[model samples]
Target: MEHRISKQMIRKIPYFEKMLSHECLESKENKVVLDFDEQAFKIILDWVERDYTIILIEMDYAFDLYELADYLGLDGISKECITYFHKFTIEHLPIIIPKMAKTTKFMTSGALDAFICRHFLDIASSFSKVNRNTKKTFWSKFPIETIEYICALDLMINSEYQVFDAIMDWVLSDSYLRKCHLERLWKLVRWCHLNDKDSSNLVNHLRISAGFEAKLCSPRKADCDCVFNRAKQNCFVMIETLDIKDLRVKVLDNNFKLLVSQVIKEDTSIASNFFHDEHVSDILFDSGRRVIRIDWKQNKYNWAPPLESYAGLQRRIARSVEYGGELYEELELGEDIANGFLLLESTETFDLICFEGKHLHRFSMPIHEIYKRFTTLNNCEATLLNNKIYLLSNKAILYEAHYFL
Candidate 1:
């Protein structure tokens, strides 16, 4: 059996044109036999004929088409493949990354590579959520270079422990030979990010292994603002107004476990919300656009000088989030930016807005309507910790919580 296409139409592609133009076997015989996906070849023909109405591509086949298009020097389809991949969810990454890593074209492009690194946390977390067998299978098939790139990323939101667990899982899957990679991979884990107990345990366990050595040093000082380096250090601070003059401050870890709960006397009217000072690592409460120090360790809250009083202060935290982009969708604009998402706050709704140029991806949070009857985002003190948004009401109740990507 043979598929016949117009020679003129086929030659529109550079790969086919070059082959047929020169004194090649295809040109001499006036026929070309090629091994490729039939659907992809048909799509290429449709592209050549400008038959836009009949051309349709699916996610699974897009990769095959992309590889074939790239091989055939089809820049239009190659760029389309890149655009398709940009819309990929975290789950799609584990499937595509291994393939991308092996392709030289993908390596040279570096666009998709950066996407994987940027969303490394979601990808790693997706791995963790899967069963052990599935996770092992994933890591076993993953390219070492891609894994190393993910491990070495300074932009990850997942704790270093998760990164350590992922690498160890990969090593333990094929311990005999892969163990050699353990030392290099172990060095990539940001030891400073691990808690005291976990760090000590890891050090002790590795020290017992013969010929294992590493420098347990400071936290990774990344240039970009990741969730870890941001003002909120993976913990949400909830400000609760108790009576007229006191505010109860509670610090909750990523799991919403209470780490610190203390009541301090302050003018609750003015000190309604808080912001982070990344430089000093302080959770300073905002009072009339001024800074106030609440030394929770000492169980005291004191008013500090006005923000202007601190002359030459660089990187001042903005009192309000500015919504400057064009409204691409009909959803209400958000009042604050958390985890790189704009949030719309109102008594009836809480929404997460992903404002990409000329487009908006709005995620309406699943807050019970009954809760919305009495609760409002404006009335709650909102904070982001470990990629989850926490809305704590003035009454000290956990109003609503949602995870943002």
Candidate 2:
């Protein structure tokens, strides 16, 4: 059987080069015989010749091909296998990982294992008996390496009790057999973060394994999720500043560091004092249309589209704007409420939300009495959503204004 594979195909494969260099092939008469799996070699041969689409390759087929590539010292193909597997497993893991969890051959790839841990936590929580009705979980079926990898990602785990519950549900699935991994898996749980009730329950389950509460109390390094989560803060951007006599919006990061000063319009004096008054408040980010709506009193609204927005993502604040130009324009809602205002998209009436003194009620709406009760005052913050007014105060949400029959 002439395989017809060229020398170029094997050039990058070190194992075959070694065999030829050492004259390991059996020579009889005028021919040489090199023994190997014909089918595996055929697949590898085809792959070496650029014969197949990389994305369409099946996981199991790719796995077998990877093994053969590794054995044959096909470094190029082996590297491609790893990069593809990392992507394939993420997209296909919920269907494949359950079966792979019990197989040691598939568990050793560090990249595959780490991707599993990061994306599979929420899916794993569903198997915790309380979240669903299942006798067993894919989480419990995972190999020791996977269990440790999952446990190590504390930052990704939203609630410690969820992990504890998942581990408990795993052990309880079939304690006689599943408990075999408990001794190893229990050590990885972040016990200190659990509530006392959960801690007590776990302690009871493990008995002497949890030697002391103080033992697990040492804080581990926070993961990227934890660090990035704390980076969030409320940023108030000023629409105008006196120093430059130009319209500017200053952005501040969580640390109060000046990120950038966006020039909204060149000359602020060209516009009347209405646009520059310090009394101006409230801004609504219209992510759907990539526009920002700023309001002052109830007379009208100023609008500007973000400098960047995407087809499937929320828009961010625009870095610059030209007042009264195409990107920046004004919309008049014709109301007198200065507290705050929200525009109901594609609707005629604007829901004017007003707040004075200590008490606030969304039902104190003005559709019946015109804009008289809450006429033109500057105190509350407001936003429009689904054509309803989401009223807000400095510390908390006041209420969502709704019209009733």
Candidate 1: 10-residue stretch with minimal lDDT = 312-321
Clashing pairs in 2: 336-376, 337-376, 338-376, 338-377, 339-377
Model 2, TM vs. native: 0.37
| Candidate 1 clash figure, as a count | 0
Q: Candidate 2's C-alpha lDDT?
A: 0.44
Q: Per-prediction RMSD in angstroms?
A: 17.0, 17.0
Give one digit per residue, the lDDT tens place, for model 2 in 216-262.
Answer: 44245554122322113246565554454335676686567887566
Give the C-alpha miss distance for residue 80 in model 1, angstroms: 5.7
The regions of model 1 sitting more than 4 angstroms off are 1-64, 67-83, 91-114, 127-141, 157-162, 172-180, 190-199, 207-381, 384-390, 394-405
The list of candidate 2 runs beyond 4 A from truth reads 1-64, 67-117, 126-137, 193-198, 208-405
- Shift of residue 129 alpha carbon in model 2, Å: 14
User: How accurate locally is residue 191 in candidate 1, as Cα lDDT from 0 to 100?
Assistant: 75
Give per-model TM-scores. Answer: 0.41, 0.37
Model 1, range 154-239, lDDT digits (tens) per residue? 54344667677778767777878788888888877767767799888888767775257656766555532223432124577887
